[model samples]
Target: MDPGTNVLDLSQLRRSCSSCALSELCLPAGIGNDDLERLDTAVRDKRTLDRGGMLYRDGDPFEALYVVRSGSLKTFVLDDSGDVQILGFHLPGEIIGFDALASNQHVSQAEALERSSICELPYARLQQVTSEVPALHRQLMRVISREVIEEHRHLVMMGRQQAQEQLAIFLKSLADRYQRLQRDSTALTLSMSRYDIANYLGLVVETVSRLFSRLEEMGVLEVNRKSVRICRPDLLAELCRSSGVPASKRRDAG
Candidate 1:
């Protein structure tokens, strides 16, 4: 948890992370062992962020691209009207600050939604490593491609989906992500608050609360304070497609 501490042992870190649930999505699929080791060396810090902590703010110097080792993060932007628009949520094994790679300043703010750990790879060092490690460059390309795809999905969700439909798709998406981490996909503990969800969904808190009640009453979800269980995933998916709710809205609803 200490930013100053060497929280990861290099040899063990490489071995442990190589088999991590996210490895297939993260590392270069066909990377050689030596390249993997080189990539590991680029990681400079393993820092822990507590709930409500700011990982980095807009205009903060872009130093490193962080990989979520555990827990969840929310990225958002504040408008001139003082309203916060949630951009996206990052889960374990996902990369943060990818947008910064193309610009000198960060495009948005990243904050911890729960106690989280991230591995930081200094940008300059990573660039240097990539120059010498072809596999690393390929891996970086894949990461960027994934980001683009996710962004495209968000844009579609925002433009097309309705509130209830969006919420259903969001729950299913979160459940899929949890399943990847070997967690229970049906039941989830929400680290982000209802107010945050409302802001992200572009709805009032009352609307968000009402949606939860409606879904619960319909036997589609089991809702508790900051916790949820999807009782009918198939039905939820149908709602997402039929209602055309934005994915971000659904994700925030729970």
Candidate 2:
């Protein structure tokens, strides 16, 4: 074996998935160690976005999916009325740009809520790796599926759930996502501001503030500025489960 070839392989080996803290959340459970190297190779670029930076703008040509290696982002669109419509929030271990895969052009803009690192998975390379690795393909599908499910959850929240229920579901969902990344689920910092949350949840800023105050009074949670501590997750869960939207209605909408 050539010594130079051995050295190059060692360099690639050092970039394996085990080095990523969010690997367990991003990759499927059964991926082979060898597949991790393939993934690392497919990740062609690492880009940093400062707070308020746009990852990709509406109508930008999209040739890759970006995974949030660190930081947070919000995907939004400007409606015909020139109003900003919040789509969703992205956290570490979550992948964005899946929407652009269908049309090859982004319909919404992804903006960083804070300074963040992103891993770019070029479409061509991702397809090549997915073709070679069944687990990789499945993992990508699962991530896309979760995004779809989350969208539906948001729709249900807005369409029928009360303001309190909507807030509960949102908080509970955020907690669950953080837990998946091995973070403290009960304690979290809101990267997206209150204004953004209100926009996304279809509530006015004052209404959002009132609802948070109500929840705090209920002793279900504590909120100080952007820091949230879930004092009673059980109570929060109950509120989410009792969302005014019935199961039959959800199924029919689907």
Q: Kindly provide the TM-score of model 2 when superposed on the true structure, using C-alpha atoms.
A: 0.89
Taking the tens digit of each residue's C-alpha lDDT, what string does model 2 give over 86-117?
Answer: 99999999999977888889999999999999
> Considering every candidate listed, which one attains the maximal TM-score?
2
Which runs in model 1 stand beyond 4 Å of their true positions? 1-21, 244-254
* Residues 117-173, model 1: lDDT tens digits: 888888998998899888778878887887788777677766654777656656777
RMSD of each: 7.1, 5.6
lDDT of each: 0.79, 0.87
Question: Which pairs clash inside model 1?
Answer: 157-246, 161-244, 161-245, 162-244, 162-245, 166-245, 167-250
